[model samples]
Target: MTTLYGYYRSSAVYRVRIALNLKGLAYDQAPVNLVKGEQRSEANLARNPQGLVPVLESDEGTPLSQSMAICEYLDERYPEPPLLPADAEGRARVRALAQLVACEIHPLNNLRVLKYLVRELEVDEDAKLAWYRHWIIEGFDALETLLKRELGTGDFCHGDTPTLADICLVPQVFNAERFECNLSAFPTLRRIVDNCNALEPFQKAAPSEQPDAG
Candidate 1:
Protein backbone atom coordinates (compact mmCIF):
# COMPACT_ATOMS: atom_id res chain seq x y z
CA MET A 1 0.00 0.00 0.00
CA THR A 2 1.03 3.61 -0.43
CA THR A 3 2.45 5.29 2.69
CA LEU A 4 2.51 8.97 3.66
CA TYR A 5 5.07 10.56 5.93
CA GLY A 6 3.75 13.77 7.45
CA TYR A 7 2.73 15.73 10.49
CA TYR A 8 -0.93 16.10 11.28
CA ARG A 9 -0.96 19.88 11.54
CA SER A 10 1.26 20.74 8.62
CA SER A 11 -0.87 22.54 6.03
CA ALA A 12 1.12 20.96 3.21
CA VAL A 13 0.49 17.54 4.67
CA TYR A 14 -3.14 18.35 5.23
CA ARG A 15 -3.38 19.24 1.52
CA VAL A 16 -1.93 15.90 0.41
CA ARG A 17 -4.26 14.04 2.73
CA ILE A 18 -7.24 15.81 1.22
CA ALA A 19 -6.09 15.11 -2.32
CA LEU A 20 -5.57 11.42 -1.58
CA ASN A 21 -8.95 11.13 0.07
CA LEU A 22 -10.62 13.00 -2.77
CA LYS A 23 -9.09 10.51 -5.20
CA GLY A 24 -10.39 7.70 -2.99
CA LEU A 25 -6.88 6.31 -2.70
CA ALA A 26 -6.18 4.25 0.39
CA TYR A 27 -2.87 4.97 2.06
CA ASP A 28 -1.07 4.49 5.36
CA GLN A 29 0.18 7.35 7.50
CA ALA A 30 3.64 7.42 9.05
CA PRO A 31 3.77 10.38 11.35
CA VAL A 32 6.78 12.68 11.28
CA ASN A 33 6.69 14.86 14.37
CA LEU A 34 7.73 18.23 12.96
CA VAL A 35 7.50 19.93 16.34
CA LYS A 36 10.07 17.41 17.55
CA GLY A 37 12.29 18.15 14.54
CA GLU A 38 11.79 14.66 13.13
CA GLN A 39 11.48 16.08 9.65
CA ARG A 40 15.19 16.93 9.75
CA SER A 41 16.15 13.47 10.87
CA GLU A 42 18.38 11.36 8.67
CA ALA A 43 15.58 8.99 7.63
CA ASN A 44 13.37 11.80 6.42
CA LEU A 45 16.30 13.53 4.74
CA ALA A 46 17.01 10.35 2.80
CA ARG A 47 13.55 10.55 1.34
CA ASN A 48 13.34 14.33 1.00
CA PRO A 49 16.53 16.33 1.25
CA GLN A 50 14.45 19.43 1.84
CA GLY A 51 13.22 17.73 5.04
CA LEU A 52 9.61 18.58 4.40
CA VAL A 53 6.57 16.74 5.59
CA PRO A 54 4.09 14.82 3.36
CA VAL A 55 6.57 12.50 1.67
CA LEU A 56 4.47 10.02 -0.25
CA GLU A 57 5.88 6.55 -0.85
CA SER A 58 3.99 4.99 -3.70
CA ASP A 59 2.74 1.41 -3.66
CA GLU A 60 5.56 0.59 -6.03
CA GLY A 61 8.06 1.71 -3.36
CA THR A 62 9.12 4.91 -5.09
CA PRO A 63 9.09 8.00 -2.87
CA LEU A 64 7.59 11.37 -3.83
CA SER A 65 8.37 14.67 -2.21
CA GLN A 66 6.54 18.00 -2.23
CA SER A 67 2.78 18.26 -1.67
CA MET A 68 1.96 19.85 -5.04
CA ALA A 69 3.88 17.19 -6.94
CA ILE A 70 2.29 14.42 -4.95
CA CYS A 71 -1.18 15.86 -5.45
CA GLU A 72 -0.65 16.25 -9.20
CA TYR A 73 0.74 12.74 -9.37
CA LEU A 74 -2.32 11.34 -7.68
CA ASP A 75 -4.56 13.30 -10.02
CA GLU A 76 -2.74 11.98 -13.08
CA ARG A 77 -2.69 8.43 -11.74
CA TYR A 78 -6.36 8.49 -10.88
CA PRO A 79 -8.27 10.77 -13.22
CA GLU A 80 -11.81 9.88 -12.25
CA PRO A 81 -12.44 13.18 -10.49
CA PRO A 82 -9.85 15.58 -11.82
CA LEU A 83 -8.32 18.08 -9.47
CA LEU A 84 -7.48 20.49 -12.33
CA PRO A 85 -9.80 21.81 -14.98
CA ALA A 86 -10.05 20.24 -18.42
CA ASP A 87 -9.09 23.37 -20.34
CA ALA A 88 -5.68 25.01 -20.18
CA GLU A 89 -6.98 28.40 -19.10
CA GLY A 90 -9.07 26.94 -16.33
CA ARG A 91 -6.16 24.81 -15.15
CA ALA A 92 -3.98 27.90 -15.10
CA ARG A 93 -6.51 29.69 -12.95
CA VAL A 94 -6.70 26.82 -10.51
CA ARG A 95 -2.93 26.60 -10.28
CA ALA A 96 -2.64 30.35 -9.71
CA LEU A 97 -5.08 30.15 -6.81
CA ALA A 98 -3.25 27.21 -5.26
CA GLN A 99 0.11 28.92 -5.63
CA LEU A 100 -1.19 32.10 -4.08
CA VAL A 101 -1.57 30.21 -0.84
CA ALA A 102 1.19 27.62 -1.09
CA CYS A 103 3.89 29.89 -2.43
CA GLU A 104 2.99 33.28 -1.01
CA ILE A 105 1.01 32.91 2.21
CA HIS A 106 2.22 29.58 3.56
CA PRO A 107 5.95 30.10 3.06
CA LEU A 108 5.91 33.30 5.10
CA ASN A 109 3.99 31.69 7.99
CA ASN A 110 5.45 28.19 8.07
CA LEU A 111 6.70 26.72 11.35
CA ARG A 112 10.35 26.90 10.32
CA VAL A 113 10.02 30.56 9.43
CA LEU A 114 8.26 31.30 12.73
CA LYS A 115 10.96 29.45 14.63
CA TYR A 116 13.61 31.42 12.85
CA LEU A 117 11.92 34.65 13.85
CA VAL A 118 11.62 33.68 17.52
CA ARG A 119 14.75 31.61 18.03
CA GLU A 120 17.18 33.26 15.62
CA LEU A 121 15.87 36.78 15.13
CA GLU A 122 14.43 36.98 18.65
CA VAL A 123 11.05 38.37 17.67
CA ASP A 124 8.63 38.74 20.58
CA GLU A 125 5.55 36.52 20.79
CA ASP A 126 3.15 39.31 19.90
CA ALA A 127 5.27 40.43 16.98
CA LYS A 128 5.49 36.88 15.72
CA LEU A 129 1.72 36.56 15.76
CA ALA A 130 1.39 39.91 14.08
CA TRP A 131 3.77 38.75 11.40
CA TYR A 132 1.64 35.69 10.78
CA ARG A 133 -1.65 37.56 10.73
CA HIS A 134 -0.31 40.20 8.41
CA TRP A 135 0.58 37.80 5.64
CA ILE A 136 -2.63 35.81 6.03
CA ILE A 137 -4.74 38.91 5.69
CA GLU A 138 -2.82 40.12 2.68
CA GLY A 139 -3.07 36.82 0.88
CA PHE A 140 -6.67 36.09 1.80
CA ASP A 141 -7.78 39.53 0.71
CA ALA A 142 -6.50 38.96 -2.81
CA LEU A 143 -7.82 35.40 -2.83
CA GLU A 144 -11.28 36.58 -1.81
CA THR A 145 -11.31 39.16 -4.57
CA LEU A 146 -10.37 36.55 -7.16
CA LEU A 147 -12.90 34.06 -5.93
CA LYS A 148 -15.73 36.54 -5.57
CA ARG A 149 -15.21 38.80 -8.57
CA GLU A 150 -13.71 36.33 -11.04
CA LEU A 151 -16.05 34.17 -13.02
CA GLY A 152 -16.43 30.37 -12.57
CA THR A 153 -16.30 30.23 -8.76
CA GLY A 154 -19.10 28.14 -7.34
CA ASP A 155 -19.33 26.10 -4.11
CA PHE A 156 -15.59 25.50 -4.42
CA CYS A 157 -12.75 27.75 -5.61
CA HIS A 158 -13.30 26.63 -9.18
CA GLY A 159 -16.54 25.28 -10.50
CA ASP A 160 -19.15 23.34 -8.52
CA THR A 161 -16.66 20.55 -7.66
CA PRO A 162 -13.67 20.68 -5.37
CA THR A 163 -10.36 21.17 -7.17
CA LEU A 164 -6.69 21.88 -6.41
CA ALA A 165 -7.53 25.44 -5.46
CA ASP A 166 -10.01 24.25 -2.85
CA ILE A 167 -7.49 21.74 -1.50
CA CYS A 168 -4.96 24.52 -0.93
CA LEU A 169 -7.59 26.91 0.40
CA VAL A 170 -9.19 24.85 3.19
CA PRO A 171 -5.87 24.18 4.94
CA GLN A 172 -4.80 27.82 4.81
CA VAL A 173 -8.14 28.86 6.29
CA PHE A 174 -7.70 26.26 9.01
CA ASN A 175 -4.28 27.67 9.83
CA ALA A 176 -5.68 31.20 9.87
CA GLU A 177 -8.41 30.15 12.26
CA ARG A 178 -5.91 28.32 14.44
CA PHE A 179 -3.95 31.53 14.86
CA GLU A 180 -7.14 33.53 15.44
CA CYS A 181 -6.67 35.61 12.33
CA ASN A 182 -9.70 37.80 11.76
CA LEU A 183 -11.51 36.40 8.71
CA SER A 184 -14.65 38.54 8.65
CA ALA A 185 -13.33 40.39 5.62
CA PHE A 186 -12.94 37.28 3.48
CA PRO A 187 -16.47 35.98 3.36
CA THR A 188 -16.08 34.37 -0.04
CA LEU A 189 -12.99 32.47 1.04
CA ARG A 190 -14.80 31.33 4.17
CA ARG A 191 -17.82 30.21 2.16
CA ILE A 192 -15.66 28.08 -0.12
CA VAL A 193 -13.88 26.62 2.89
CA ASP A 194 -17.21 25.84 4.54
CA ASN A 195 -18.34 23.97 1.46
CA CYS A 196 -15.07 22.00 1.30
CA ASN A 197 -15.27 21.09 4.99
CA ALA A 198 -18.79 19.74 4.56
CA LEU A 199 -17.47 17.05 2.23
CA GLU A 200 -16.44 13.71 3.73
CA PRO A 201 -13.05 13.64 2.02
CA PHE A 202 -12.10 17.05 3.36
CA GLN A 203 -13.43 16.30 6.84
CA LYS A 204 -11.50 13.04 7.00
CA ALA A 205 -8.34 14.92 5.98
CA ALA A 206 -8.69 17.63 8.63
CA PRO A 207 -5.80 18.09 11.05
CA SER A 208 -8.05 17.16 13.98
CA GLU A 209 -8.96 13.90 12.25
CA GLN A 210 -5.39 12.80 11.61
CA PRO A 211 -3.86 9.94 13.60
CA ASP A 212 -0.93 12.05 14.79
CA ALA A 213 -3.07 14.96 15.98
CA GLY A 214 -2.53 15.77 19.62
Candidate 2:
Protein backbone atom coordinates (compact mmCIF):
# COMPACT_ATOMS: atom_id res chain seq x y z
CA MET A 1 0.00 0.00 0.00
CA THR A 2 1.03 3.60 -0.55
CA THR A 3 1.16 5.60 2.69
CA LEU A 4 0.97 9.39 2.69
CA TYR A 5 2.29 11.35 5.64
CA GLY A 6 0.75 14.82 5.67
CA TYR A 7 -1.06 17.59 7.51
CA TYR A 8 -4.59 18.54 6.51
CA ARG A 9 -4.05 22.29 6.07
CA SER A 10 -0.55 22.13 4.67
CA SER A 11 -0.76 23.28 1.04
CA ALA A 12 2.12 20.98 0.16
CA VAL A 13 0.19 18.04 1.46
CA TYR A 14 -2.91 19.34 -0.27
CA ARG A 15 -1.06 19.11 -3.59
CA VAL A 16 -0.25 15.43 -2.99
CA ARG A 17 -3.87 14.66 -2.16
CA ILE A 18 -5.02 16.22 -5.43
CA ALA A 19 -2.49 14.21 -7.38
CA LEU A 20 -3.56 10.97 -5.70
CA ASN A 21 -7.19 11.66 -6.48
CA LEU A 22 -6.48 12.65 -10.05
CA LYS A 23 -4.53 9.47 -10.59
CA GLY A 24 -7.40 7.39 -9.16
CA LEU A 25 -5.04 5.59 -6.77
CA ALA A 26 -5.96 4.13 -3.42
CA TYR A 27 -3.66 5.03 -0.58
CA ASP A 28 -3.64 5.32 3.20
CA GLN A 29 -3.14 8.72 4.82
CA ALA A 30 -1.15 9.31 7.98
CA PRO A 31 -1.65 12.76 9.50
CA VAL A 32 1.63 14.41 10.50
CA ASN A 33 0.13 17.21 12.64
CA LEU A 34 2.26 20.03 11.27
CA VAL A 35 0.99 22.70 13.63
CA LYS A 36 2.05 20.54 16.56
CA GLY A 37 5.57 20.36 15.12
CA GLU A 38 5.32 16.66 14.45
CA GLN A 39 6.84 17.23 11.07
CA ARG A 40 10.13 17.85 12.89
CA SER A 41 9.81 14.67 14.88
CA GLU A 42 12.47 12.06 14.28
CA ALA A 43 10.00 9.76 12.52
CA ASN A 44 8.98 12.40 10.03
CA LEU A 45 12.49 13.81 9.65
CA ALA A 46 13.60 10.31 8.68
CA ARG A 47 11.16 10.39 5.76
CA ASN A 48 11.58 14.06 4.79
CA PRO A 49 14.68 15.88 5.90
CA GLN A 50 13.06 19.26 5.30
CA GLY A 51 10.57 18.65 8.15
CA LEU A 52 7.71 18.99 5.70
CA VAL A 53 4.35 17.39 5.35
CA PRO A 54 3.51 15.09 2.40
CA VAL A 55 6.23 12.45 2.38
CA LEU A 56 4.82 9.74 0.16
CA GLU A 57 5.90 6.18 1.05
CA SER A 58 5.49 3.48 -1.52
CA ASP A 59 5.54 -0.25 -0.81
CA GLU A 60 8.33 -0.41 -3.34
CA GLY A 61 10.67 0.59 -0.46
CA THR A 62 11.39 4.25 -1.16
CA PRO A 63 9.57 7.19 0.41
CA LEU A 64 9.35 10.31 -1.76
CA SER A 65 9.77 13.90 -0.69
CA GLN A 66 8.69 17.07 -2.49
CA SER A 67 5.10 17.18 -3.73
CA MET A 68 5.97 17.75 -7.39
CA ALA A 69 8.44 14.86 -7.46
CA ILE A 70 5.93 12.59 -5.75
CA CYS A 71 3.27 13.68 -8.22
CA GLU A 72 5.48 12.90 -11.20
CA TYR A 73 6.34 9.55 -9.65
CA LEU A 74 2.65 8.70 -9.50
CA ASP A 75 2.25 9.82 -13.09
CA GLU A 76 5.05 7.50 -14.20
CA ARG A 77 4.14 4.50 -12.06
CA TYR A 78 0.41 4.52 -12.75
CA PRO A 79 0.41 5.80 -16.34
CA GLU A 80 -3.37 5.70 -16.62
CA PRO A 81 -5.64 8.74 -16.53
CA PRO A 82 -2.43 10.63 -17.26
CA LEU A 83 -1.73 13.75 -15.16
CA LEU A 84 0.31 15.39 -17.95
CA PRO A 85 -0.58 15.99 -21.58
CA ALA A 86 0.71 13.69 -24.35
CA ASP A 87 2.43 16.31 -26.52
CA ALA A 88 5.76 17.68 -25.27
CA GLU A 89 4.77 21.33 -25.67
CA GLY A 90 1.49 20.82 -23.81
CA ARG A 91 3.38 18.98 -21.06
CA ALA A 92 5.85 21.82 -20.68
CA ARG A 93 3.08 24.41 -20.52
CA VAL A 94 1.25 22.39 -17.86
CA ARG A 95 4.40 21.95 -15.77
CA ALA A 96 5.16 25.66 -16.11
CA LEU A 97 1.75 26.66 -14.78
CA ALA A 98 2.15 24.23 -11.89
CA GLN A 99 5.59 25.62 -11.08
CA LEU A 100 4.31 29.20 -11.11
CA VAL A 101 2.12 28.31 -8.14
CA ALA A 102 4.15 25.69 -6.31
CA CYS A 103 7.49 27.47 -6.62
CA GLU A 104 6.60 31.15 -6.78
CA ILE A 105 3.55 31.45 -4.54
CA HIS A 106 3.97 28.78 -1.87
CA PRO A 107 7.59 29.13 -0.79
CA LEU A 108 7.22 32.71 0.46
CA ASN A 109 4.23 31.95 2.67
CA ASN A 110 5.68 28.89 4.37
CA LEU A 111 4.99 28.46 8.09
CA ARG A 112 8.62 28.76 9.11
CA VAL A 113 8.91 32.03 7.17
CA LEU A 114 5.77 33.39 8.83
CA LYS A 115 7.04 32.37 12.25
CA TYR A 116 10.30 34.12 11.56
CA LEU A 117 8.37 37.34 10.90
CA VAL A 118 6.67 37.16 14.31
CA ARG A 119 9.50 35.73 16.37
CA GLU A 120 12.54 37.46 14.93
CA LEU A 121 11.37 40.43 12.88
CA GLU A 122 8.62 41.21 15.41
CA VAL A 123 5.84 41.46 12.88
CA ASP A 124 2.28 41.87 14.19
CA GLU A 125 -0.80 40.03 13.04
CA ASP A 126 -1.85 42.77 10.64
CA ALA A 127 1.61 43.05 9.10
CA LYS A 128 1.95 39.29 8.75
CA LEU A 129 -1.41 39.19 7.00
CA ALA A 130 -0.39 42.03 4.71
CA TRP A 131 2.75 40.16 3.70
CA TYR A 132 0.75 37.01 2.92
CA ARG A 133 -1.99 38.81 1.00
CA HIS A 134 0.51 40.74 -1.09
CA TRP A 135 2.14 37.59 -2.42
CA ILE A 136 -1.18 35.90 -3.14
CA ILE A 137 -2.46 38.83 -5.14
CA GLU A 138 0.72 39.11 -7.15
CA GLY A 139 0.90 35.40 -7.91
CA PHE A 140 -2.79 35.04 -8.64
CA ASP A 141 -2.83 38.03 -10.97
CA ALA A 142 -0.10 36.51 -13.11
CA LEU A 143 -1.73 33.07 -13.00
CA GLU A 144 -5.14 34.44 -13.97
CA THR A 145 -3.67 36.30 -16.93
CA LEU A 146 -1.94 33.16 -18.19
CA LEU A 147 -5.02 31.03 -17.78
CA LYS A 148 -7.34 33.51 -19.48
CA ARG A 149 -5.04 34.48 -22.33
CA GLU A 150 -3.59 31.06 -23.16
CA LEU A 151 -5.42 29.06 -25.82
CA GLY A 152 -4.73 25.79 -23.98
CA THR A 153 -7.12 26.46 -21.15
CA GLY A 154 -10.60 24.97 -21.36
CA ASP A 155 -12.64 23.22 -18.64
CA PHE A 156 -9.33 22.79 -16.79
CA CYS A 157 -6.03 24.69 -16.50
CA HIS A 158 -4.32 22.88 -19.39
CA GLY A 159 -7.23 21.33 -21.21
CA ASP A 160 -10.76 20.04 -20.55
CA THR A 161 -9.26 17.22 -18.45
CA PRO A 162 -7.53 17.73 -15.14
CA THR A 163 -3.74 17.94 -15.45
CA LEU A 164 -0.67 18.94 -13.45
CA ALA A 165 -1.70 22.61 -13.56
CA ASP A 166 -5.09 21.94 -11.98
CA ILE A 167 -3.38 19.85 -9.29
CA CYS A 168 -1.29 22.89 -8.33
CA LEU A 169 -4.06 25.48 -8.85
CA VAL A 170 -6.70 24.03 -6.51
CA PRO A 171 -4.46 23.85 -3.44
CA GLN A 172 -3.23 27.42 -3.89
CA VAL A 173 -6.77 28.71 -4.31
CA PHE A 174 -7.82 26.96 -1.12
CA ASN A 175 -4.94 28.63 0.73
CA ALA A 176 -5.77 32.00 -0.85
CA GLU A 177 -9.41 31.83 0.27
CA ARG A 178 -8.35 30.74 3.75
CA PHE A 179 -6.28 33.90 4.10
CA GLU A 180 -9.26 35.99 2.87
CA CYS A 181 -7.49 37.07 -0.29
CA ASN A 182 -10.05 38.87 -2.50
CA LEU A 183 -10.53 36.60 -5.51
CA SER A 184 -13.32 38.50 -7.30
CA ALA A 185 -10.88 39.58 -10.02
CA PHE A 186 -9.87 36.09 -11.16
CA PRO A 187 -12.94 34.72 -12.87
CA THR A 188 -10.95 32.18 -14.85
CA LEU A 189 -9.26 30.77 -11.78
CA ARG A 190 -12.54 30.66 -9.91
CA ARG A 191 -14.20 28.79 -12.79
CA ILE A 192 -11.46 26.17 -12.88
CA VAL A 193 -11.58 25.74 -9.11
CA ASP A 194 -15.35 25.42 -9.13
CA ASN A 195 -15.15 22.69 -11.74
CA CYS A 196 -12.53 20.88 -9.69
CA ASN A 197 -14.72 21.01 -6.58
CA ALA A 198 -17.65 19.56 -8.52
CA LEU A 199 -15.73 16.32 -8.89
CA GLU A 200 -15.91 13.64 -6.18
CA PRO A 201 -12.16 13.00 -6.06
CA PHE A 202 -11.24 16.62 -5.53
CA GLN A 203 -14.05 17.14 -3.04
CA LYS A 204 -13.05 14.07 -1.12
CA ALA A 205 -9.47 15.29 -0.92
CA ALA A 206 -10.40 18.74 0.44
CA PRO A 207 -8.69 19.75 3.66
CA SER A 208 -11.99 19.97 5.50
CA GLU A 209 -12.83 16.42 4.46
CA GLN A 210 -9.52 14.94 5.55
CA PRO A 211 -9.30 12.73 8.64
CA ASP A 212 -7.00 15.20 10.41
CA ALA A 213 -8.80 18.48 9.64
CA GLY A 214 -9.35 20.51 12.80
Candidate number with greatest lDDT: 1
lDDT of 1 by residue, 1-214 (tens): 6999999999999999999999998999999999899999999999999988889987588889889889999998899799999999999999999999999999999988999999999999999999999999999989999999999899899999999999999999999999999999999998899999999999999999989899
**Model 1 root mean square deviation, Cα atoms:** 0.8
lDDT of 2 by residue, 1-214 (tens): 7899998999888888988987888889999997889989999999889898789986586889999989999999888889999999999999999999998999999999999999999999999999998998999999999999999999999889998888888989999999999999999999999999999878988999999889
> Model 1: runs farther than 4 Å from truth?
none
- TM-scores across all candidates? 0.98, 0.98
Clashing pairs in 1: none
